[model samples]
Target: MPRPGSHKYDIKRSRLRNELDDAGIPDKRADELANEILRNPRGLRARLTHVARRFVPRPGRRGT
Candidate 1:
């Protein structure tokens, strides 16, 4: 039997896979990447920083 949060972990994994797919990553590669990220201690923070950088503009001159 799975532990109490096993189902939740599965759900989070599935969501990560879907997000990767939506970003144009192939299914197999997405699964691999998702698993790698989830297995890392700092994965969540790293992933969040990566995603946040996409939306948040960098402070710099108009054209450099």
Candidate 2:
């Protein structure tokens, strides 16, 4: 469990929350995600993607 009362932890958590929010996650969900990420032993070792977007060619167009 993380020490939510610590000032440093709070500051970091808030920063993570803001990043998540900018990533298009809802405020509530972002808070949850931040908590989970903070609990990781490696501390954000891997990139997280709630939804991955890819570039798709147009229906009738293809790379020449």
Candidate 3:
């Protein structure tokens, strides 16, 4: 059994590193970012920016 929070991937780590390197990122940077991606504690949900939402009009409102 895999440990808690383990990432499941078909590709080996060396292959991933090579692919990242092939993608034009520096080897060290790619490896660091890849490790961070797999081991991130906060999970992979996209974080929203702090921008205010647009004013959406409510449907079915009575006409004044």
Candidate 4:
């Protein structure tokens, strides 16, 4: 049997993939992107910012 949080993680990952699909993203690509975001230290926030950046431009200058 999986650990306590493992099931929750699976549910969350599945939900993320489903949301991506609902947004019209291809299944394979969505899965890949979801996995990438989940691999990040701040997975949920990283996923949000990744999607948000497509519609919202950064406020700061382009280059430092």
Candidate 5:
């Protein structure tokens, strides 16, 4: 069986992606950022900052 903490990583990452999506980020960009963070979670703060810089509001600025 997996250790207790084994699933934590997945759970945290999923939450991060969901937050980004809920905040109007695109799925493709969110996935890419999530993958990068997973690969180097040690500097997550910096990574997230970088990802934040990449986001640009959608052209129409309208919600679904």
Candidate 6:
């Protein structure tokens, strides 16, 4: 069974992923940002910025 707050995190992650997609954020950056949050309880702004980095497209070659 999922513990308390587990479902909430899932919802939040989904929302964040959707937002990142809408914003055209790269998959790697978006995943990194989401994983970082789940991995630790860090500052708000820093985490958000990290997620935002995904939006920036890279030149040449497809991102993994």
Top model by lDDT, which number?
2
lDDT values, one for every candidate: 0.69, 0.70, 0.47, 0.69, 0.69, 0.63
Candidate 1, residues 3-63: lDDT per residue as tens digits?
3248876777789889977876679977876776676747768875775465445788342
What would the per-residue lDDT of candidate 5 be over residues 1-64, giving only the tens digit for each residue?
2222468767766877888887667998776676567767688899777665566545777534
State the weakest 10-residue window (summed lDDT) of model 3: 47-56
For candidate 4, write residues 1-64 as lDDT tens digits.
2232487667766887898878766899888776666666467786677776764457874622
The ten-residue window of minimal lDDT in model 5 covers 1-10
Query: What would the per-residue lDDT of candidate 2 be over residues 1-64, giving only the tens digit for each residue?
Result: 4577688888889998998888677889889878888777464655363222222244687733
TM-score of each: 0.57, 0.62, 0.42, 0.55, 0.54, 0.49
True-structure RMSD, every candidate? 5.6, 6.6, 12.6, 6.5, 5.8, 6.5
What is the lDDT for 25 in model 1? 67
Candidate numbers, best TM-score first, in rank order:
2, 1, 4, 5, 6, 3
Error of 1 at 7 (Å): 0.6
Give the worst 10-residue stretch by lDDT in candidate 6.
49-58
User: What TM value does model 6 have?
Assistant: 0.49
Model 3 has an lDDT value of: 0.47
The collision pairs in model 6 are 25-55, 26-54
Off by over 4 Å in 6: 1-5, 38-42, 49-64
Colliding pairs, model 2? none
